[model samples]
Target: MRKTIALFVLTLVICSCVSATPIAVAEGEADRFESWNETDFLKDFVSNNLDRTVATAGEEKAGDYVLSVLEKMGYTTRKDNGLTSAKQRFDYVDSINGDANVGYNIVARKDVSGATEFVIIGCHYDNLTSYELNGEKVGGEGAGEATGVAVMLKLAYDLRYETLPFNVVFVAFGGNQLGLYGAEKFIGANQSIVDNTLLMLNLDSVGVGDYLYMYADEVSTKHEDFVYDLSEKLNLDVRKPPKDKKIVAAKIRDDSKLPYHHKGLLSENSLFLDYGVNTLNLFGYNWTGEGYGGESENHPDIVGTKRDTLSNYLAYYSESGQKKMETATALVKAAVTAEDFSAVMKESKKEKFDYSWLVSDKVRIGVSLGILAVLAAAAALVYVKLDKIQKNSKKAEDKSDDFQKQSEKVFEDF
Candidate 1:
């Protein structure tokens, strides 16, 4: 019995000390994007489009291209036109027309048998009409957004045949430049999906930046840390938002007291974070630089400008951009395919209770004034009652004294 108890204790210790092993990727896995002709696809996709502004012909063409690619990959593909099967509309107001417009969110899915959860990978394919930078107007080619779409496509194609533990859904969101309309529509139409989502990985502007940055919802950092660890293993230079005054000021300025608002960059991931979903956003930007530019030498701030063309990206920063994409794909692939993904997800799933109402200055001030008013009323009522009692007691004592004096006077008269 003593030996058995000792052995049981030893087993418990071993179990307690042993951590879950994350998925491992071979070094060559990072190069799969190049090997599988995904880089060529990226170049072609970006080159063929002038700009994918929402509600335009270019946007429609881009959406069609995404659908065709997914269909060829042997996956189930559909277009979510910001509408629910129940006929509910999740459309957004067009900035130009001021009319309701449906942003086509291209959704492609690969299902695994017995999988109850989903891993969503998303990217915005829309670009701004134009951006005025340094007093010069420039057209928006949106190379960064295109890069994200290409990365998502590569991931979809690579994972097409694999039997993942969870269902993988790839989304190319539309009208992201105007607003996060596409992402919002997706969440609104798929309430059930929101509940079953394990993780939402967002790739935005992941190439052509100075450095690769990873941002996660404030609810938990486990997913972010896991990807960061993967980056380290792969010898990729991945960074988190620095705690600098500029970054902090930006966060504060954009603070809506929402989960995603606390993060540095805002994208379609914001909507997912708002829904309390565990989201990982991989963006390529230099947090240390001004105006979304990278800190690296010659890293131009070309994201929203005409200079964001594929040619410029290739000519200046192709090597670094490709490396960043490779790193992002490898890290994301490893994370979603990790052997202990469920375990990691369980740890990352934290209930992010919004206490903003309780912490709001308006609510606090209102509540404080309400309590003060109640206390003041109670104090005044108590004071009035005490004063009445004191006066009544004094009157009774005076009456007693008068009665005694009258009785003494009557006795003297007698």
Candidate 2:
């Protein structure tokens, strides 16, 4: 009985000692990134083609890659493009209207509108494989920008059939290495999508080992705040700068029609404002963009070199990176589905900050249970011994009475 009590106590103690943690659910996009293994792809891209120094063929390769994934995700080849001259009708239109061959904005559209709106998750996959100084490759080719394509494809494949509030369009913009041209092409052609787009997240130089720097034009103050708050609550190390006085002022006086929900410059001065959407830009190296400095300045010169490969992170598994992506995706899911950014932020903060006092509470419960069990068992044993003694004593007394009765009978007979 003591042994049973001890065993029960031990089990209770163990149960109290450990508590489960929440696991990650990519929802539907497992292939979007194989997490740590992504470094292998980065290494492969850097070793084979560190040539994003030029701005032409790099974007085409990236664009085609996006198209392939979109096709895999059930999006047909884009036939009606409004920005690129390739789809035009006349020589005049092609000449006066346009002049280059790199590639067009690659966007895949799924017909099913799970939500009334659309969310365009874009990534600038173009690279300067060879930088041209006046139509010639300058210095040398650079590390091609392919990871954006790789990551975007991963998302495309993952979200293909998964239920979502908004249908997603994966975009690979060319001319990013040149001057955000590919991104510009996409925004220009899909202007309507901009207004209707719930949010725009662009992945650049991702899939490598580096601090993921998230950026936003003047149109993303509140959204940025939401992201930062979410990240902090989760204890993630992401690069999101608080808007300085200047940035806030810029967002206020901007003169564009697009409504800036973010608490930045209210004026629509930049193209980001035209869409009424938020842009999350990723700078792979040097962190020249806003709210991105520190070690980023000391990192590799990813803008022009092929050094920005998966191997950049081969030595270390980046928990920080995964947390960033997961958090961002969760944020998008919340804002789009709930139509409430504040609500999502609050909820995520609660979840991220919440701790189950499981370890402590369980310990107390276990100890209490063990003590009670031990006491109860000891009482039962004592009761059993007492009952035995009482029974034995009763039997002896009855024997004595029987003997006495026998003697009295003998006397009476005599």
Candidate 3:
């Protein structure tokens, strides 16, 4: 009886711990995050009926919305005009018109006097074409990545007035669904800006999932620590991929883990990765390690569909989820505001070069040939060994047959 009572007490304790609410930071530089209105801004921002298609009215309106928010925050905003050729290269052109279809990257800058290095925080505001399970064309909507756009807006607002150790640029990419065209263009044209950037944080699908995920790489330890610190404070679940595992956005269903290929950049962060930029991707939803059962925007069927609206997300996740998003926003803010973040990113001046030609065809061809040669050598050795074994076995069988025949004849004579 005493043991049973003790077990019950332990269960209650664990439940209480799990149910505990996250409190705002009472002291320190990150305390401004406590005042952030996470959902109010997000709901209004995402509510805009922006279709995510490249070069469409919805895309333009969405870009305008991002610019409006940044301008309200008192940041210098501009439409980067250099990515027109990049849009052409990606084949994001209209069928009716022969002109190259392109979307502008709304770049908002917060310059710090005497600070040479800058940080880039970006997400795609454009939506994708919705399709049915049978691959039939259906009506498209702006619900999928609206949450990500909201997150960027909130970040701009939260950090607008604060002076930091480095300059900051908040960029909303236009042609993400059309193969990361916006990001590709930004990288191509702004080689100088890209060089000065210390880190790039990409937010996507922030409105769903039970756990916060930080897709990290070798140079993003400071970013990882910031998210982890937030997790500890809020008692929120957080996950990072193991070193050997690929840094990817993945989907997890009941008992199964599948990789989510975003079609462009494979994942939005890959654009920066291809350029060897320091990057960290923050999103809600895990379905990666140990498998999170909580569903969020990472759901393949839900995101980029008409169903990914504000009402649906709120109803599906409940008010607590919004609160969680607030916490997530706070954590990201903390990371951005951390004093030591800029110190780790010092680098020599970067020369202007087209990253499109960064990887030569000859190098790719050489690597492919090397792999093919190794595979061919392995196959040949395996075939030779198998052939020798088969020949030896056949010889042994023939010898046995001869002996049997000789024995049979001997027995007949006897």
Candidate 4:
């Protein structure tokens, strides 16, 4: 009996040691993410839901589809009826005959054990109903809009079971086309969530553009840098807006007075910046265009136009669109599941100095003119001083000649 008891104690000790061994850290590396096949889903989504204009049946159907997708993935879903009380504040609401209940933001949350911080993944699902462009009433094709939501959904599906250091919240905002009403409402309602959020990644127009770019507010520079580095590791082509173009664009919009304008895009991401939250906006826009804005004539003509149809997008930019979606998904996955997310969160809170003014044409032109004026004045002063010296030297030479003649006359007279 004594021998049996000793053996049982030894077995217990061995089991405890084995169980106490720490598991390997969860590093959301590039190798872990493979190429995602979302082409079928993207094509189908855009085909079925073509006109997702705000306060319309099409928009409601799109919202329901998003909720169903999340529910099918075993996620508990909820709705935040954004800014119900202040419906009168928006002029578009009246124009569209939209009431307080028009835009409802669909929210799905995944909680991690013992996690204090949260990461928000958001995108708007609404597009223009029908707008007259070039004397033709065109349906809203919404290829870019569909692509943004598709990437968000794909991320949710991919990261559903992963062990992340922070909780994840996915939001599909409504009434975005109607002036960012849904995003504003969500921000107002979820103050606590916004307060503790480590990063809010906003995906907008990730398809049918010439480039895949990322933008972040000034406070979230670390997050931007980290994601850009990760993209390089993944062999993805992710870029930021050109410094000179962004400066010119910001100057045209008169965004100089806004403190965080340089760091952010004019999208739903701007709403989060208002609450001092770190935000990264993954957007596909044509920065190679000679025109100033993303939607200039030189850029791809999609988003709110007839050509935004999936068929058109696929016909023209199918390969580039797929690559953009894949890059966005991989980068977001790597970022959210990063082992050093806590460190990133801490670093992202520290705001960086804004250097946008350095590249601004207004500032550049002013400094250039100032420099030329100074140079011209210096040249004039130098020329005047040299002229005075030359005149004095000539006078001195004449006096020397006169003295030599006087000495010669005195010697001859002696």
Query: Worst 10-residue stretch by lDDT in candidate 3?
Result: 1-10
> lDDT of candidate 2?
0.44
Better of 2 and 4 by TM-score: 4
lDDT of 2 at 289: 36
Clashes of 2: 34
Per-residue CA lDDT of candidate 1, range 283-398, in tens? Answer: 77767766433535576567766677777777766788888888888888877777888777767776444536744789869989999999999999999999999999999999
Sort by lDDT, best first: what order?
Answer: 1, 4, 3, 2
Which one is best on lDDT?
1
Pairs that collide in candidate 1 are none
Off by over 4 Å in 4: 1-36, 77-101, 131-139, 218-220, 247-264, 293-300, 352-414
Residue lDDT tens for model 3, 299-321: 43356555666666666655655
Steric clash pairs (candidate 3): 52-126, 52-127, 208-296, 209-296
Question: For candidate 1, what is the TM-score?
Answer: 0.71
What are the lDDT scores of the predictions, listed in order?
Answer: 0.66, 0.44, 0.57, 0.65
Write down the RMSD of all candidates, one decimal each: 17.1, 25.7, 14.7, 17.8
TM-score of 3: 0.70
Q: Which of candidates 1 and 3 reaches a greater TM-score? A: 1
Model 1 lDDT, residue 53, Cα: 67
Q: Write the per-residue lDDT of candidate 2 for residues 231-334, one digit (tens) a residue.
A: 66656556653444222211111223322223222111123534445555543432333442322433434334434344443333244344434444444443
The top-ranked prediction according to TM-score is 1
